[model samples]
Target: MTEPVKLYVYDLSNGMARQMSRQLTGRQIDGIWHTSVVVFGRETFYGQGISTTLPGRSHHGAPLQVIDLGETAIDEETFNEYVMEMKDHYTADKYHLLEFNCNSFTNDVIGFLTGGSIPDYIKDLPTDFLSTPFGAALRPTIDAMYRRPSPSEPTPPIPSPIPAANATPDSQLAASILQAVAAHTQASNSTPNAATQTLYAPIHAITNPPSFHSFLKSHRAAVAFFTAANCGPCRMIEPVFERLSEEKGVKADGTGAGFAKIDIGVGLGNSLASEWGIRATPTFIFFLDGKKLDEMKGADANELRSQVDLLLFQAYPPHPHTSLSLPAVQALSLNPILFTQVPAIDTVLTRLSSFIDSNPWLSTTQSPGQAKQTLTGTVAPYLKARFSAAPSSKLPSATPTLLTSWSQATSAIASALPVASLFPLVDLWRLALLDPSVGTWVSSFPTSSPILLFIDKATAALKIPDPTSNPRNYLLTVLRLLSNTFATPALARSLFLTTRAALAEVVIPSLLHTDGAVRTAAASLAFNVAAFLQKGRVDKVKGGGGHAARDNTLEDEDWEVEMVSAVVEALGRETTSEEVVHRLAASLAFLLRLSPAYDTQLSPLLDVLQTRAVLKRKLTKGGCGEDGVVKKDVRKLVEEVANKLCP
Candidate 1:
């Protein structure tokens, strides 16, 4: 699950700066901007050193504006872990209004959550204020107020929020912060002063014996470098060691080899060196399963590399699947496809206005008339402002009221309008669902929802004359909208279970769509379904003790068989677009890749359906578009899938 991330913008000077900015600074300036990040049920800001409070309950009182920064897949436990690490750099005495204030802290947190930074208005407020002549004169005074003390003495950061039961105790949390701050101070004092430069080394620095022991116990295999400041050979070989760390030491799945270093001249580094019985200035030790396996005294780069590789081999044996030649299928991205293109806001609003003006029943009835008024008055301006803004600009919050109104208005308006005329409304709602607030609300709807109603009506209309005929604009737009709904993870998960049959009804027939655009949209939706299911398996495998375990990923075996059968049939019929054929093949790979019952359930089903023959014929038939060049990439992928199926 993901939490919606919001930026709470508070005016530090309240209304005073806005009122008296011209008189004080000889220029117009907005209120002094203070921003905090609100996520996972906590509002975190930096003032008295990274404080946290319930949202909107800070001493700063209410926020002037709340901007929707989007959602993050980070859970609360992981987010708090980040906060604990942040306590070191954001101490109470480190606070400076102009240099590193509330906005600085929020920008970092926001970047971590959404991979996006805070707005320019909030971030650049300090520079804008200091640029004024009157403000420039007081810069020195402000600097004097927040002067840095000696490097020896450092203030401990404020304690983190007291977590609930089964969490880290308050005393334990405070002790950890103090220990970290003390270690940082000791390391700073011990190291010879040097110019700072950015380095791409990911090696963990061991300062104390306890942490060193913990690090060794946690990783299956680890390498520790022991060195001192005065050792010339240590300095010379450090760069090579850093390069190795960058290349093979860090991984997202936590299976990468561990690399660490200890400086014998700083803090308890000497204690570790003595405990490990290392008398040399530059020494290397390789460990496997938390026991010392191999030891080398000198920093021979070639020997170090070979020993590290040997340690990894001993720790983690290679899986047989690693021998498979399936580069084309392996290279396929598992990210879901989302249609985020913004249509003209004025055009959409104008069409909505005309629809409302022409329909007599819409204005004559009570609920429908109120719904029409809500659409025109509330939703029209909302879309205009949101869709018209730049992509990076902060958007107005989609409140619960607006979402509720939109749901009722769209459903009520659909009842009054013809199925063909509902495309514009679906398109508008599609854009609205991109907002996390709106998406979460709509996804919580059980089986009956206005969005689902529109989809059912649209698909029901598609079978008007013949099933094989090309889909109408209404159904095409509805398919695109359905594909976009997977942008919200919750909605995608629910669609697989409660509304599984409804989704299969719309997706199966659409996969064989006559129009390439309709077929492409249907393919995108199928890819999303497969990706979501594949993710569950990938996560399970990662969490289930070993990376090489084969896990049963089928959440619903019946639905999986149904979707795979449709895709296989679609592949046989697909001759026009090689890109669509590649998507179908990729979806098939995701569905069958990690299934425990692949041999019994999927492979036999594929064999009976003649999947290998269908794929080989595609290779023979060649490509679509532009003189039939036989898209080599598509053929490679299809051939690979066929091999996997039959092998």
Candidate 2:
């Protein structure tokens, strides 16, 4: 279920909110002091920092209004990741009582969690106050009184009728200043270290940027390494330029980054480069915050590297540890395959014979059930041949050719039969794939593997919402089986880079599906796929010791984060299936193991203390039957894994 978010309005002065406002602004006003937002994630509730409700911190009393902002689309994990990202920009030192305050922080946090912002009324309050003549007259005292101790340390004044009631000097001073300003026509007062950081690789390719204006604007700083074709020094530094690209253009952790490369010698560059007055090779133009910081001409390797290095730091300040590696990742297995649980075909077929055999030919039938039955005899054999050990002696088509055949065959059959008619084929496909001989042979097949195309079709087949209605469940099972094939390193890399998104589209959302079985399958699919993604990473890249495997990954993309968030949120719920819960836990473990970006330092998957407590309670509850015992065991294991991974 989508989680709820609440915007908490704090008056801070108990019942004296109106009096305090009148005393501060010399005008009757609505309750306005400090505001916070509490997000009810999948599992627990979270507030910006601390609220008046916090123990030993009740000087501000209860909130004036706890306004429900509707359900958030992102799950808790994604929200937490976003919260960490905001912490990067919204440190206490950045706070200004009037310019950048708790309210701004609240807006950024909620914006990341839900695409929505703080209420229009609440946002307009400060702008309204700042625009007023009386507010202007008292601006100096207000600014002086509420000045933040430091950029990262916010000491926003708590509005109260009597400053002595709070027993805090800062609050007292702020109240007095507000009161004095209202009565007077006066003016007002005003309000990563380098090294331990990492640099994302820069873009090194010689190409023109799409929308240069937007590209430079996106990064805090960007360098356009313009080079000429005949430049010898340019050739000498080509390697360094590319290395710089990797360091500054990509991410420190390699999720993704922002930077670019352009050559004036090119067609489009002819005009743009001339506009910039670049006539030399290896000319480096450095920009910070969309304005030119500096430029370099005839700069040697040392000079170019140093200048770009500085630009990179400005563009992407280094974070000490954004990445993590696990050596045992490749050893993780994809099984136990769900196909083992497939029911006997003959028994199910006998029961459905009436629904299917009723219409011998699909051309006249409107029912998917009946149409499906007719194609069973024809397409089943074709697919079985595709998967089976025996040779057809027809000289099988090339991988791409096979894809064309598969697409044509499926399209034709789908037109006549219900899509479910082709679902059973996956069962045959899984069994044949399990055989080492068949799996290896398929992997080694000629150029342009057809498995990629097959995956695209298989995912399209299971796109239906209702898993229980047809054999769509079987289709999902086949996808799990297909994940196993990627264990072959070559196949794993190819699949993850090319086919990961297609399967991800099928797997991630289904974790939140209403059907328990669907959710279980989805979680299992994620577990296997994430495991495969881990196996695909190589030890080293063209550049020294750094790994380039994840440079092109889409894992950190917004949609991907949202998907993982949904998965974690589902895990926090009261689940019915032990397998679902187990796989969900396993999937999170895989993700944590997959990258350090998923680490607790940035964003913990859950409130470790609370998640562990919940798991412990379930363990103590004790199971009775076999299923119950398995559930209990899984509960304990998940708790242990979560404990290790979260910290």
lDDT of 2: 0.50
Clash pairs, model 1 backbone: none
Estimate candidate 1's alpha-carbon lDDT, on a 0 to 1 scale: 0.70
The lDDT values for all models are 0.70, 0.50
Residue 448 CA error for candidate 1 (Å)? 7.7
Where in model 1 is the C-alpha error above 4 Å?
Answer: 1-325, 352-368, 389-392, 445-449, 462-471, 545-554, 621-629
Q: lDDT (0-100) at residue 466 of candidate 1?
A: 63
Maximum-lDDT candidate = 1
lDDT of 1 by residue, 1-647 (tens): 78999999876554656766776567776777778899988899876667788999877778899999999997888788777766754655545556455676676677667767778777656556666764554444344334444567543233322333534443343334333322322232342112111112245555556556655765677889999889999998888887777555523334546777878765456778999999996899989878999999887888887777667656653422333667886788877888888888668766866775677555423465587678778887787677665643777657778877677677677777777677788888778767776667777764334667966886687667765443366777777788777788888776666667787788888898788888888888888888878777656544431333444433777888899899999988887887788889889888877655566678789988999888777766343444332777877888888986544
- Give the runs in model 2 whose Cα sits over 4 Å from its true position: 1-407, 431-478, 481-495, 498-501, 512-519, 537-550, 574-576, 594-596, 599-637
